[model samples]
Target chain A: MTARLRVVSGLLILAATVPFASWWEAGLVRHVLGHVPLLVAAGALLAPRGGRPVGQPTAIAAVLVAAFCIAFWMIPRWLDAAVNSPAVDAAKMASLVLLAGVPVGWAWPRLAPLARGFVLAQLASMFGILGAVWLAAPVRLCNNYLVDEQTVLGRIALAVAVAMVVAGLVAALAGPGITRARPAA
Target chain B: MRSGGLALVAAVVAAGAGLLWWGTEGLSVFTAETARREAVALAPRVLPDITLQDEAGATITLDALRGKVVLADFIYTRCPTICTVQGSDFEQARAAIRAAGLGDDIALVSISFDPEHDGPEELAFYASRFGGADDIWHFARAPSRADTGALLRAAEVIVLPDGIGGFIHNSAIHVIDPQGRLVRILDDDAWREALVLAQALADDTAAAAPVAGGAGT
Candidate 1:
């Protein structure tokens, strides 16, 4: 798809998620997993083509920042706060969609095969771990969410983890042409 | 440069493992002790000696229960959610205490937030359904809506309209010391701790009193 189309699609999703942001399940689906990747798609499309490839240091910083932002939102306290406080919720939506996604999109294409795989693997591991925890926890972690809702979220996390793994494997076995020859700086 | 990048990747992996451990433990790093302390810290400066009416329309105050350790919880008779689970937990705790013969020293009270609906009759019905006894497990209500609101605020219980004219509130058990001081609000998971703490508080009060010297003094 064209860059403009990707941006438009991202914008459409951002708009669609606003209504469901108040609900816990919708918040996870639309904001955490949905808009995050959609916004990344837009960012990748909009990335400047004329510039030299993003350096290793900058790529690392981008991934780190994106990872941290995503991880912070995954926290039960932050998730509860977002549900209780409108300002915090808005911050969650904005930071995840804008701050996390754009940098990841810009840096991902510039990263080496090993670094890319590492990032994907990290996300997959996180989902799997958190999924297992939420599913197995006997007590409710979030004050606003019910035990059943938490379990449903755990299932979603596991499903996402599996999908991430499958996607990573597919990319790894795509072809020899998938490999980047440039040495990562 | 590539090696440094790989090292960074290694660091991220290590961090991921650490985080995974923490998450799998259900944020266990924030121990139950910490939750107890924080909940206690959030109580109001002074627990008001507010009047509460039992299901039979009998008026009682916190001061009346001062000599005993009170385990309090907020609930509405019509609540179809967490209150049920909380009530069940309270039942188990009650049984545990009674089985240990600590029933007289520790009193369990469920304060209704919906005073408009959960009047004496409704509360009585709820108490009966939940197997609450008038002498042991008392179901009470605030004398007025305003009083109920104040009590809810003082207890740090957040109540919101569920859009169906019902309310959503925290599931917690407030522990009041023998001195009538609001001490800790144990989370639902801490029911076992509540029994232990209540017993301890009662024992402390009993231990502090000079039974023989009272008449001479």
Candidate 2:
């Protein structure tokens, strides 16, 4: 599709959807998009035109994390909470739809296994550090990290952000290697 | 690739970005900080499996709390906001215990998350606020941050303060059986009714063992 069309579709979606969560009133699109849009921008910048295609783009990590997020993290949580919380269950659908729309960098060659492993390990490390620090800190300190005892739910949004950043950086870095021979018209 | 397809993908991404921005702003509106739970769904979050320093500076393991129904709440005297609400709620719970006359059987403990600010003296003041029996009503502050955090997390009641005197936290009172196992969460948004429920539970428990026959059977 033409760049113009890509831009327009992206804008139209912005107009059509007002993101909402399940449990409570109102929408949360603005709060999250500040960080999410970077992924889209990264993907669009890394779109390959010709030649061997760069194997990795920063957006690759983002898409991978987002995809994994939908599968492992988000689904179980939604299902678990859906049983007891209408608000959360409702928000789950809205979150899925919105998350589904995030763009891609369209890397052609694909990442080396090392890069993929790095991304995964990085997230685990982040979580580990957060958890460790959280354990050592005061209970009041955790109020910033979470609102309640259910660490799984309270930490989801942050986990998503970290995953995106890690993946987005990978996608961005991949641009140089794959784009050497080809250029999008 | 089809221009339309690429465009479709971009559209999706952009839309996601928009939604994310909206969700963040809207989500925090009534966050726990601003809005409190109307009716608490009290889950029995077990207390940290550690020995704690009592008001007397004695090592009182939760095991030591056995043989008595224990009522536990977390607080820091320095707090001016929700701590006050929580403290008041706790005091009310204690009063309710007294009113119900389960004073001897039930033990009310106000553990402080801020051990530094809530040492024995501060807890004494906090206990003083109620002006009741000091024997059953005891306030203990952890000696270290890790211990305090563990206890608070285990209790599922975290203490967060707004830069100023205001505090933010979850107020779910726990009732433990004589064995120290957390049995029930008190849902007295207003301590007035909570004590009644606590008393009823204690009475139920007391009567349950007696009603069931023993060795002779």
Candidate 3:
């Protein structure tokens, strides 16, 4: 399973870096969509299964790193730089994969249920707030993207935020028993 | 172990803050466009002396326009949307400058980045449509693609093909002083303020001159 997961993760990264990178050059929405796969691949590669228990401090540090990475990349100037400059683009991919994706994946299983819930809630709120700001901004936030594209990306972000919130609530209510039992069965 | 963890966390937080501070230019500029505007405003940049042909096919260089404050905007003749608004804004600005009798002190220029399609004739039509007058208002295009790109880069104007024969670009009134340095960039809607600033700069140039008419030829 681990070997297969690694292969899948590798393929995901390849798809995002090659085709999605070229495809997203023009539109902010497409650019953001392209980031999703990179983030997922990064997490999938480092996903916990039967590893030694991670220390609480390590988990907290990882979470902080991941959060900072995400926030850093989301800044408009940095986002524009990543889009325009090939060097910055490579750095963005590396940081998102290593700092954000890997850290989040490594920290996930180590975090307490309450801490996990808090992370999810924070993510949801952050997305919603960013979405609202993008939608309402009178001027284009990124120089490379059109105002219309920004609005479309904003709507997509809001949808994703809503979906995440719903998923978190469902997971919380359903408990771990159903999910854990299914894999065992 | 707990103290070690705290130290690590503190270090990460400090690093993140530092990166953020640097990335946002000390937290003063939030967007790339804003950063460009702020940087230009802080230190005015001398524009490139690219060869351009006015609507009448006469060759002109930014260096030649050193005595008069120039309000320049980038546009393509075929631009269907924002360029139209820019044209109208320029017309209003031209009228306001003339009314204020600063036409000699201020010159309005629209530079076409799409030089492939916007030749002398096309520019002439665009100028006519906006009531662009000779000398006071000029619709100009670079003679070559390379020169056009250079001017756009010098002015920090980012232009991307819309993939539909149109172009997507950020529009603003770039105010050039009497010394040919790009001193200010105003929003497309702020042409009035741009004109006012240009008049002030022109006045300052005239005042600083050793002799009357020494600034402009």
- The model with the greatest lDDT is 3
- Tell me the lDDT of model 3 at B75: 94
TM-score of chain A of 2: 0.31
TM-score of chain A of each: 0.80, 0.31, 0.83
Docking class of 1: incorrect
Model 3 scores a C-alpha lDDT of 0.83
Clash counts per candidate, in order, are: 0, 39, 0
Please state the error at residue A68 of candidate 1 in Å: 1.5
**Which wins on DockQ, candidate 1 or candidate 2?**
1
Q: Better model by TM-score, 2 or 3?
A: 3
Span of 10 residues, lowest total lDDT, candidate 1 chain A? A23-32
Candidate 3 lDDT, tens digit per residue, B66-178? Answer: 89999999999999999999999989888888788887899999999998899999999988888855768988999899999889888878887777878888889999999
How much of the real interface does each model capture, measured as fnat?
0.05, 0.05, 0.64
Q: If you superpose only chain B onto the true chain B, what TM-score does each candidate give?
A: 0.77, 0.68, 0.93
lDDT of each: 0.73, 0.53, 0.83
Quote fnat for model 1.
0.05
- Where's the lowest-lDDT run of ten residues in candidate 3 chain B? B208-217
- The alpha-carbon lDDT assigned to residue B4 of candidate 3 equals 84
Error of 1 at A127 (Å): 2.5
Better structure of 2 and 3 per DockQ: 3
Two-chain DockQ for each candidate model:
0.22, 0.06, 0.57
